[model samples]
Target chain A: MKLEIELIYKQYVDYIYGFIYGMVQNKAVAEDLLQDTFVKVMKSDIDKIENMKAWLITVARNTVYDHWRREKRKLNLMPFIRRKRRDIDLKLDIERGIEKLSPKLKEVIILREINQLNYKEIADILDVEIGTVKSRLNRARKELRDSLEG
Target chain B: MNCSKIEELLSPYIDGELSRDEIIRVERHILECKNCEELLKDFQLIKEKVRGIEIPQPSLRIKKKIIGYARPRNYFLRIIFSTSLLTGLGALLVLTLGHQPYIAEEKPKEYYIMKEERTPYMEILYETEGDYILTNYEGGSL
Candidate 1:
């Protein structure tokens, strides 16, 4: 059991971490979410998971959403608190633009571009049709390009 | 194909997800339509930039911490067993050797301090201190 979990960790660590980081845009938060993602994976019945990578990515995505929901709640409670912006490098301007996108658009872009998951895989993860994925990706690219240009 | 139809197919076309017939139609339309061609170029640039964005690797400490959580309880037993075995071996060696302490000649302690200095052969275009130090020279770091 330990060996199986370790193997899964070694296999999907980069993909899971990249996906989480792409969503959160914060290394510390991403790492915490990554830990939570694997813990969820460990608790799940591994035998039932047909697509391990997609499963792990879905868990990571949910973990990010949960973090965001908690953050949103906290902000609502303390409306005066403001989140500080981190220093983003010039090279990461594209990534910063991605971070500014709406959650639905940002998710498709990350799943497609960063994680390099196929349309079918992304559709499966997001529980949306392939057409919806296509439209979302198109809108996401358009928004990202406009932001960068402006 | 109309421009709007072509625009709808643009994402799938760029992703190579379109059917062969659709790909041919889009290609033919793009050749004659300047707007669609420019849109394709823009999408290509967006794809390139997104793909080029660097993803930071999770720290090794975090990896260890997460993997440690999944370790089975038997791992502890294995560690304890191995430790006991080593201790037993040590006791057996001591018992066989008798309590006579072996004395060895003492040697003076030697200390050497080493300093590393990097002399820039050419101009340093960029330098960042971290896991990766990317430097660009007149020619190239490579």
Candidate 2:
């Protein structure tokens, strides 16, 4: 069991962090909450868990929500210079274009492109139907293309 | 299908979610039609751009920090958990042993007196064998 946790942590911690960072956009906050999410999973009875990856993602999502609830009164705790410069020009442009999208569409794009999640997984994460995920992702991609082309 | 219907299916087509038959129909329609072909190109451009967007490799520091945070030995939570555990144990100990429920360890009896001049003494008027005692002196009453 201990080995399992260590292995899972080693394999997925960075991926989970990147996935969440893409959403939250603040590394420090994402880091703290990522830890909180793992702590939550560790404390939970692991025997009941069937899908560790999905379960971890759900925990991470819930932790983000809880963090927002606790810190809602604090205004914009994100540091200004913390936004790292993009490594690739085109990728950065696409990322910036994604940032310009509405939150709903942006989430779909991030989940699909950045996270590389399937449409069904995106639908599950967003708690929407698969059709909704398809539509939102399509709209997000269309918006990005138009922005870049123009 | 009409142009709008074909356009609506283009996104799913690009994703390859359509059936093989549907793919043939769409391909044939786009091959002959200028407007549908243009729409297909636009969708294709979007897909290419999305696929081209590089996965920004996180720094060693970022990885360290994330792993550090995600580890079980979380700083704040550990402190809170230990402190609460200690407090609960202490409270349990006090409840179970300090204030013995079965023994009836009487609280120290408090005596009040109004003094006029001297320090009044407690005079035992009657005495029992083991523990009980009575006091009757007027000075003791005062």
Candidate 3:
């Protein structure tokens, strides 16, 4: 079991951490959520999981939402509170664009772009159909582009 | 489909997620539509930019935390130990209850079967002086 945990952590720590950071955009918060996600994994039946990477990402996604729920009062004002300190770098512009996206779009883009998961994997993670994944990804890409262009 | 619907397909087309027909349609539309072709270019650029977004690495403490999480717990060890102990006990009980010394209280059924084979015309004799003698019904005993 210890070996199992170590092996899993070693194999997936970076991607899982990157995913959380991508979704939350906070190093501190992402770290906390990563820990929380692993803790939840530790408590459950890890041995029975067939797809560890997908499962970990799913847990991390849930952890992100759980954090949002806990911080609902503060987060509800985030869009209004978040002031634009736009960087000229197109990369930074898109990152900001992604940050401003609604959670549904945010998740699909992050899971698709950052994690580089296929449509099927995104569908599985989001619990939606592949058609929905495709449409959401298209909309997400367009929104990000439009947000930066305008 | 209109340009917007065609535009909706640009992402999947870029990712190679579109079906063959959809891909053909997107390609055909892009050949004629300047706006969508440009939008496709922008979406590609956005995808590249998103990929370019600096993925932050977690602090060393998180790695340490993960390593720390990998440490063996007493409960896991306890569960293994208990399971093995129960299995051993079960094996022992099966061996104890199922195994016994065999004793033949009477002649085996095969002996009676052999004895029953003798008939009015059949002959059976022990060496020299026998337990019984069987003779032909003509009764010429030699």
Best-to-worst ranking by TM-score = 1, 3, 2
- Over the stretch B1-142, how does candidate 2's per-residue lDDT look in tens digits? 7777677677778877788988888888888889889878877877777657544444566445434544445579779979999999999998888676564677766544433211101121232244433322234331
| DockQ of each two-chain model | 0.25, 0.08, 0.22
Which is superior by lDDT, 1 or 2?
1
Question: Who wins the lDDT comparison?
Answer: 1
DockQ pick, better of 1 and 3: 1
Candidate 1, residues A1-150, lDDT tens digits: the string is 778888988888888888888887776678778888888888889988888888888888888889888777766775665434334443376877887899999999999988998899999999999999999999998898888888
TM-score of 1: 0.74
The better candidate by DockQ, 2 or 3, is 3
Taking the tens digit of each residue's C-alpha lDDT, what string does model 3 give over A37-131?
A: 88888888998899988999999998998887766655464434332233223336776788789999999999888899999999998899998
C-alpha lDDT of candidate 3 relative to the true structure: 0.77
Which consecutive 10 residues in model 1 chain B have the weakest lDDT in total?
B115-124
Backbone clash tally (model 1):
0
Q: How should the candidates be ordered by lDDT, best one leading? A: 1, 3, 2
